[model samples]
Target: MAPQKAAQEFVGHKLLDREGNNVGRIEQIYFDDRTDKPTWVSVQTGMLGRRHSLVPLQGARVNEGDLMVPFDKERIKDAPDLDVDRHLSVEEENRLYRHYGVQVPGPRRGMQDQGDAQGRHAAGAAEETGMAGRATGEHGTDTRAANARAMNAEAADARTAEADTRSGRGRADAMADEDITMVRSEEQAHVGVESRESGRAHVRKSVDTEHFEQDVPVSHEEIHVERVPLTDEDRATAGNAQIGEEDEEIILHAERAVVAKETKPVEKVRISKEKVTDVQHVEGELRKEHVEVDREADHLTEDDYRGRRRPPAG
Candidate 1:
């Protein structure tokens, strides 16, 4: 496809180099004055896309909806820097052609030839008019002088118009060069939560010992002898018994305390985790960009121009 058509189709799309590396995005396209074909293009580059670079459109192609040029990223970045004010001067265009080692188009040379031809034609017409005036004598001489004056006036008017056009173009160029852009940026605070091992807890069991005490009652047998009161009954009961040397025996018993141990579960115990949310007040020093404009005029102070306006007191 033609370079001009390709440029129109893929404008605002990514520009890739021959090695498949991204150069930038195509922002603007330029065309040749005589041929009306795409000659150069401006690509937006740099960190913030604040910078633009010009690259030649020769040997350019479109692939996969992107404009690809036969140049590397470094070569395009290091190309000549020129003003992109909707037109390119002959000198500026020639410089680019030379830098890229491309042959200058033949149409520009044809334009120079056409100009020389016009100049020669005008010179020949003047010579023929002078010869005609000489042949007609004084009458033709006055006519010739009048014609010369008219031609001179026309030429002067043309020069004045040309100068005015050039002056306006100069002012426009100055304005284009003076255009500046400032970008203001600031830091933002982004807070997030992360899980870490702050501390730990454990549930365990251990055995312990204690002492107990209590009181109890007991009974035992006792023997006693009396003299006068039981004499007749005791004597009668003892008369049936024979006196003998014999031993008496008896059994005695008492209560005692006993202790034993048994195992049983009193309560269930286990480890668990839960989330508790709370807000924390965080503070830090943030850096930011502030823009100040300075204007030079006949009667205005820096404070008056740069400072904020305040309301008057009542």
Candidate 2:
């Protein structure tokens, strides 16, 4: 039995599923009316935070610190899904005991036999409201903390198993005898501690997060300029044009060469030496005149004698 004040604190307190690891938190406690003691606890499980189940608190042990729960995380996870109402029922409690393979110590009896305030059956009004918020039994045991721990452990274990399976490995090596070191954040731990409270448990805690900043090189490749070949028509036209130009140039050069070869320049010729000849004239006229005069001398001598006679007379 918890202390009175502690009991008040623990009324909304949690119970965890550590043995048959299941993710859940304690909703409320279902006490046995016959013994005026708490029996099984109702736990809400699953991701949506729905699906309430009842787990027998028989062999379920609590830790000294009222913090951690020691149990086989995996087994609890695989346990049967519990209905909220039936688990609170006597018959439902029997079914869970049988399913879990646990022995029920108490004799089989109906809830109505128990006395007032401690009856197995709740008040008529509580009964009418259905199982939504049925408060039965004297000690209101809050299993919220225990349930949170169990659920957390179950979730952690499941994640670990999944990770292990993904890595193609078997069950994880045992972390510690009390708590399996699957993984849990300090915030989660805080939440687990306060999950039993009526309000939300918002405990400030620090976590070591490995942040990665990597520089991935993005390379831009050099693009080359492509040169497309000329078409057939263009090639033919260019070839013809080149050939015509080359032929014209060749003909022009040939004509210029022939003209240059045919042209001749005049050159002066030099004479080496010249010779001069002189002719002599002979005088033989006096002899011929004297001969010619001899004939006439006779006639002249008569004429001269007549003239000399005339000059002598003058």
Q: What is the C-alpha lDDT profile of model 2 across 116-199, one tens digit per residue?
A: 446433464344433322322223653544454565568669979988786654333332334533433221111111223344
Q: Rate the local accuracy (lDDT) of all candidates.
A: 0.77, 0.50
On the 0 to 100 scale, the lDDT of residue 279 in model 2 is 56
Candidate 1 per-residue lDDT, tens place, 14-131, comes to 9999998998888888877766788788998654665688888889887788989888888787566667765777777788788777887765755788999989978976886686
Q: List the candidate 2 regions with Cα displacement exceeding 4 Å.
A: 2-8, 11-14, 18-22, 64-71, 74-82, 85-87, 110-314
Backbone clash numbers for all candidates listed: 0, 21
Q: What's the true lDDT of residue 153 in model 1?
A: 70
In lDDT terms, how accurate is model 2?
Answer: 0.50
- lDDT value, residue 248 of candidate 1: 82
Candidate 2, residue 276: CA error in Å?
99
Quote the RMSD, in angstroms, for model 2: 76.6
Collision pairs in model 1: none
Estimated TM-score for each candidate: 0.38, 0.30
Best by TM-score: 1
